[model samples]
Target: MNPIVYAIPIFFLMILIEVITTIIRKKDYYRVNDAINSLSTGMLNVTTGVIFKLGIYTLIYNHIALFSFDGNALWVWVLGFLLQDFFYYWNHRKGHEVNILWASHSVHHQSEEYNLTTALRQTSTSFLFSWIFYVPMATLGIPPHIFLTVSLLNLLYQYWVHTRHIPKLGWFEYVLVTPSNHRVHHAKNRKYLDKNYGGVFILWDRLFGTFIEEDENYEAIRYGTLKTLRSWNPVWANFHLYTEMLRDAIKTKSWKDKLTLWFRRTGYRPVDVATPMKMPDIHAYENYNPEASKGLKVYSLFQFAILVLATTVFMTISHNTPYGFNLLWTIVLALNLIGTGWLLEKYTGLIAVEAIRFVLSGATIFVSNGIWINLIPTWAWQFIIVSGAVSLLVLQASGIAKPGSNREGNTVRAAGS
Candidate 1:
């Protein structure tokens, strides 16, 4: 069973508790559009992972493992956990240092707000290369189950540290990763830019000289990337950096730079394509919090709830489904997320995308003879159809389908409009 299946409910419960805490404290920490956008990226990552998860680790373990260890041994479990953490530290650090890797890892830091949802903002493409870092555990004969368990545990450990409500721990700060340490990791301030890369333990950062304390008195930490992702489209968020890098590679005069630019340091740019751009004042920056109508917000929340349920269904049954069905389902889910983002951003002409999604969803059921996703009962699919139809009618009635609904002073237009 996927460990994330069990943690899904707990993740939402903690978010609910944090929401209440922030409300009682009268702090403006959560924004509906930003939270939903963060979650959209997460769903994209999860679904993509489900379809593309490789088995090279198990193959290597079976064929080339140096030594076999007893899976049930206590010490073996401890070793596996430590190994996963060590690998995660380097994977995360290199993710920030390398240009191509940063293209994938930056999704986690694109959010302008620091909240629990920010932890869910992940990259869909990191799986392409991240597994290379963990191959040593497989080669050393760590059982696949143990490695998987430790990985899930390490991931769950990092989730809680994304919140702002938690303060600095005293002695615990010196040992394990805490909220304070991770908040510094997500900040764009000069001092906190690439600090605190540990997943579960802060000792690695301290030992490796990457640790930096969160001193709010010296300068209030501003969140997000230096090149802000001003749009709420999750699909665009994942590919924007890659697109920029590709454009740079094409524009550079040197063939060596063109072929090797992605492997170079994070901020490296070719001399020919390097244009001096003004850096934003991090201390006085504002978040990309755009104006959203209450009706649109409610509609987005309702649609997101449906997507969450659909994602649960996807995760539950994807392992047993055929590759073709999984690929089709992944495409559908990606489009659903994109449409949700469009609604949240109040992007005009969403009706066209919704029409495509509606058609694909209907075909997913009909082409598979209504048995493609067995977890979703027939009644549930009917309910979704009814709900989507009603939503479309209501959206059209509210003028959301009109071309000028996203005019200035009313709603924020989509990026590049």
Candidate 2:
């Protein structure tokens, strides 16, 4: 079983505890749409990883690993853990310093509010090059299972640090990455930018001169990128930076810049491309929260709950299913995420879009007479078809099916305006 599959219930349980604590303390740490968006991107990241990730590490270990060590040795496990975190520090640091890398990494930093949900908001595209950073483990002959265990440990360690509720631990703050130091890493404040890049240990940042402490009096740390993603669309969140880079790359007159701009510093723009005349005041920034009604929130959650279940099913069955089936299922889930985002944004036109999706999904399964029959059970297909019909009726009964009803903005504006 995937270690993450076991961690899934624990993740939700901890998040539930955080939600209850925030409510009791009146700290207002979560927004419904924001939390949902964070989880949506996370599901997208994990599902896409299953569909697209290749077994480079295992293959390399089998073929060209220079040193062989016993997979069961205690020293090997300790060394693997240390090496994983060491490389993770550089991988994370370079993610912020380089433009193309930042394009993918920026998804993790898109949310203005930091919490446990924020920890899951990962990038789907990091697999493109992030594997290069850990190839040394494979070359050093660390068993793939040990490499995986250490990697999961590094990831799980970072999750709890995303919360503001945890104060600095007295001694742990210096050795390990604590909430205090990790908060500095997420801040947009000029002094805090690109600081504290460690995963489990803070020593790497200290050694590299990238460490900065959370000050008592300097200023309240402002979270998020200088350029905020003001929308809740998860697919758009992943591509927004890439879109900007591509535009700049296309517009530049200099061939060198067109080719090398992605390798340059984060937020680099070619000379010919015009920078925005005005930028947001980082000190006075407001979160990108569009108002949503109670009904809309419920509807969005309903869809999100279903997607979560579907994602869990995908993760469980992906290894046993054909690669093509996995890819197709991933696309359906991604589109479902986009639809859910539209609903959260209060796009009144989403009724038509979602209705079409439900109908198409039902019809596809009905016509194919059990697509994924070997993997997904027949009852699951019936449930999907039934859910589609039920959702349509719910929309109609709630009057949300009416076009332009309770709309925050026109459909075009809701999308990106």
Every model's TM-score: 0.93, 0.93
Tens digits of per-residue lDDT for model 1 on 1-417? 455777889988998999899899988778888899999999888889887788888888999999999999999999999999999999999999999999999999998888999999999998878989999999999999999889989998899999888899999999999999898999887777799999999999999999999885766667889988988889999999999989999998899999998999886788899855556676554567656667777877988988898898888888787877788888888888888887766657767767666767876766654555463457756875887688788878887656655442323222111
Which lDDT values do the candidates have, in the order given? 0.84, 0.84
Model 2 Cα lDDT, one tens digit per residue, 239-261? 99999989998998999999999
RMSD of every candidate to native, in Å, equals 3.5, 3.7
Poorest 10 consecutive residues of model 1 by lDDT?
A: 408-417
What is the alpha-carbon RMSD of candidate 2 to the true structure? 3.7
Worst 10 residues of 2 by lDDT: 408-417
Error of 1 at 111 (Å): 0.5
Shift in Å, residue 237, candidate 2:
1.1
